[model samples]
Target: MNDLTINTAIQTALPATFLGRHLIDGNWVEGAETFQRVSPSHDTVVSVSAKGDAAVTADAIAAARKAFDAGVWSRISAKERSAVLLKVADLIEANVERIAVQETLESGKPISQALGEVAGAADLWRYAASLARTSHGDSHNSLGADMLGVVVKDPIGVVSIITPWNFPFWILSQKLPFALAAGCTVVVKPSEMTPSSTVMMGELLIEAGLPAGVCNIVLGHGEPVGSVMSTHADVDMVTFTGSTAVGKMITEASAGTLKKVALELGGKNPQVIMPDADLENAADAATFGIYFNVGQCCNSSSRIIVHESIAEGFVARVVALSRKVKFGDPMDPDTQVGAIVTAEHQTKIDGYVKEAVAAGAKLELGGGALSVEGLGPQFYQPTVISNVTPDMPIAREEVFGPVLTVLTFKTLEEAIALTNDSEYGLSAGIWSNDIHTCLEYARHAKAGTVWTNTWMDGYPELAFGGVKQSGQGREIGRYGYDEFLEVKSLVMRVGRDSRKPWVKASA
Candidate 1:
């Protein structure tokens, strides 16, 4: 039996079902159909959201297109756009408690984690505000004695932004604010499971004084909502954060129009440990890495490639830490871990653990579901699998749970090989006391971000994305802000007679 405290006391009063509507052209509109949201943890209704169809998506696309073409938002001054962004950031801070409560209830994550994600998202908006003012293009004055060349950066018109349920508010901030910073109007589709936070963001956006039709929220599934958003001719680009399979579908959907696509998808990230490293700190980090957000994050270090000399001790340390992590009511402030998002997801996680054990891997810890005293049985225990080979699915696939797999490596070369063996190339962590080891991994690891002596520490200034099948394009920093923009070159002559023409009049 797990010794972690299962807090049975409920402090916060659950609110009545929230009404989720579509935000189109500065108006809150109702859909033809509405779907109810049942909290996975409490097994209670949390929201009733408008169900969007293809027609609704088309309307949203039209609104964004019209808004962009009319220059209602796209043609605004950078200072004006930046000021609105700052206000949005301020409003986010003001509404953190309200948003966090709903996020925890709908998403089945701990209130603490939800609070952190929502609070931290404001920084992204603030940083994007700064980016709007500093963004610029290039010019060439020495093209010729009487000629000049200039390049201008402009918004890429309408964008379709689709976010996943795991990190709804935080992920939306990553894409939406950057697009706004580039002066691009957008239509966003949040995962049906967690639509309230995005709707909440729409409320914040409007209160920040964003112009009509600048940002629209459409609630529904991927089919009619996200599908239309991806394939519509009026949408100039699609920015998505979800599974790699859906990302692939978006890539194919946008192919006809050749619209720009930016995706942050799945990851089977690994963290490498050296014998000379600080083993205690590394073990603690590994424990936190796999369990944070219940390991549902794309950046989670699901597997750890450890040097053979210290493998056994490191595994034991992590297992002990896992045993002590609190897993219970999400509303409790002291709970370290919370419920899984859904029963289906919990079953998938258990299947991976069972398959790994059947494939000759040793189960050092949990491998099944847990029923908290006051909640439904949607919680998966912190699991650890050892004696895992690089070829095993448990070691290679993106399990996306609070489960950690251990693969042993005898040398630095072997560790690096094991890290790069997977199809994913998103993020990697290296824990080593030797400068040479960390630097070598930094140079060789085929991931977008490399964390040396740390894991998953991100900054708004640093770009985030992946290589190979993980995804295309970055999500934050200067590069992320630039992704929503288009560049054009202009050549000018000082006088009418100064320009040379290649075409002859006789022709």
Candidate 2:
């Protein structure tokens, strides 16, 4: 193993184990016990975080509940909330390097990508700030001469935000600021595997002058921490981004309260390549889509449904490109692919690839663990599999890794059929130069967001979420901001002629 290091690292050697504490109400407190985070890339302990449990989860929820009920933040002026959000965005940008490094260490993604996720998240906060100023309801003035109706949007009280490990900071930004913009107080539970950055975000919230108890962070696993957040009576809503299985558990747990649940779950997102499409761009996008974030993205185009006429050529191009994708240390600027989040996850990724190969899917490029010269055995080769059938587990399941599966279709109808065959409807894309083909595919695709000529191009203004089992509710758009709010209709009789009471009581 080489001892070389990138400038992005705060120090050449591993820094002190970051002490992560729970942020409850306005205070940072220690948990019942501390858990250590060993860097998946470097193979060393990088953090020691407070391990919150049911009681701690309850405490954070109580804080958010009190803050919402108190109306300190819930009833604040939109302009004021916007100001705080803007400040938080500014602070986010200022602390990018600090947050990104820790995230890279814990999450095992490239530092460059981590930098982008943290830096890019500022735009989400900025956009949410804009939403705070613009979000409104409708007014129906055409009701009648004496009657008027007003629709008002109010913040759903305490919200529970559960974020995933992959793209942790980015996903949290997708939900948190929007909820705040909508005037909801929240308790956050980041994945136990990647909780440090959320703690850092809590610090920024304090610096941005967010009111005490408006946002609280509790670090721990699903059982007690996440359960309480989802099921608590005082919690008005739950917004979760993770696997569909866990999403189901939260759904069942939240049923008792019937609290609104917004889940951005897993996906088996597909990209269709038409015979008339730009082969080069499609191949390039396919490669990037599968490799970005090491394919640990909910929007990852894990499978490509290619037309039979172009299948062989496209597969060859993607295979050649996959071989060229640099897979190594995440801290290095040039490394395109990096370590998997854990040995277990890496094993899971390889298992899927192996299973596919065993199940008659042909391995086109790579399909197993890769050893970085100086790093631990936590990296996987950029894998590509062709001749994948619609029935294969790899083609249907969420193999959240740098692996791509290829399936073929002779007709557009067949392509659409293959794309919609899965339970996941998070995202799907088509590469076609023909306008009709692209438009037709877009309209017919069951996914929430369809890319006519691109893949996974997201914007804060464009709402994102999935249909079917990929999960419900939206995030990161006007729709996302609306998720944290409730609508109320007010009907008022104008001119107080002591308007129409159905019956006059005891004249």
Candidate 3:
């Protein structure tokens, strides 16, 4: 086996002069001002780029609007559109390794995890291509014999796509390709923290034959650029994936123009483990649930609700498994996990741990940042807390860290009630051998997705979104395509040869 140091691999694998510019209208340019792209693990200057502003954002949106209105790309048939998307997918697959390395370097996720995300991104683009052919219209029966009606799905025009930092490429792929496949032009605003891969995607799309102004990227913070995109009059829809607070702001801003807003926001998802589940497997799954990507995932199983009968065993197993997780340089193949995104985020997560500890919850395994033997800045230990109650702030809030909280429930009803208590319901899981119990929980859990025997498993073929505060609209599957399109009802008079209705009424 190749035993390569993460830092060494990173230094050798990635060139220092990698591109760090915004992609707008199938071309790259420096913004008005500049911002540094710092390495999350070592706190070093990875690169710097011109800071994009509202003007750049507005320019990108205008370009997208022109593309949609001018029918430069939107007027293509579904088959032709699918071919373009398929070509993009092929390009992504061919460059998965480079993209994966970029993702790991910027986002501080394990290299293996980044690779998975890259492959998943390819799958997502391919899935969207498949869906292009399936965007169908429905025929409806009318009241009169001569009257016929149909509902055709049409593109929702220019889309303002603002994606989060954690899974930059993967998340943007989830939103953008489907929008394009639905015949919409897009203006993308990837998070400044991890904008490299997203900008790379723009170049790849251009290489894959995407026309100018069809897909544009403006990299910057959310305050001005994102705000302008959300509030832009020409933008027909806004799709944002980020904090719940910001999502609310986007919704409010979009409301000013009555633009359709699709949000994929925060989650405090619960994982209920019944007495009959395999404790070892469930514990391992739960460990990966929160520890993956250092728990930056919106759907990470943060809440663990175990049956009273096996809570003790599950907690012990989870603690042992958490200890076994090898936290080292992300580039090392042996490293199961890597650093958190930034020092500020590490401090924020540590604060959450401290609060949970102060609130009388037992910090079973880890509860603090780790200055690991060879790592720097953005590293933290995997955390596990037990004996947590529903009322604690840590239990209810979205921590967005590698932290897991465990609680016990005596009955199935209690488990269901506790799981449904959160305002966020992005996704949840139920682990049980009893089919009836699993089925019941799946039916009652107030999340967008419910897992019966597994946790944190997802596919490009399935639709994913949340209800309530977790955000609106779906991504990934056929339902994801529907989010970017609006249904237009068409009516025709097929058999109205005589005007008998008025005559009969007069008689």
Give per-model TM-scores. Answer: 0.98, 0.96, 0.95
Candidate 3 is scored at a TM of 0.95
Clashing pairs in 1: none
Q: After superposition, how far is residue 287 of candidate 1 from its true place, in Å?
A: 0.7
Better of 1 and 3 by lDDT: 1
Q: How many steric clashes does model 3 contain?
A: 2
Error of 3 at 239 (Å): 0.5
- Deviation of model 1 at 50, angstroms: 0.5
Task: State the local distance difference test value for candidate 1.
Answer: 0.91
Candidate 3 structure quality by residue, lDDT tens digits, 115-219: 989887888888899889887999978557887899999999999999998999999999989999999999988888888888789878998898899998888
Q: Candidate 3, which segments miss by more than 4 Å at Cα?
A: 1-14, 141-143, 500-507
Q: All candidates' lDDT scores?
A: 0.91, 0.90, 0.86
Clashes per candidate (backbone, < 3 Å): 0, 0, 2
lDDT, residue 492, candidate 1: 85
Using TM-score as the measure, the top candidate is 1
- Which sections of candidate 2 miss by over 4 Å? 1-11, 496-501, 504-507
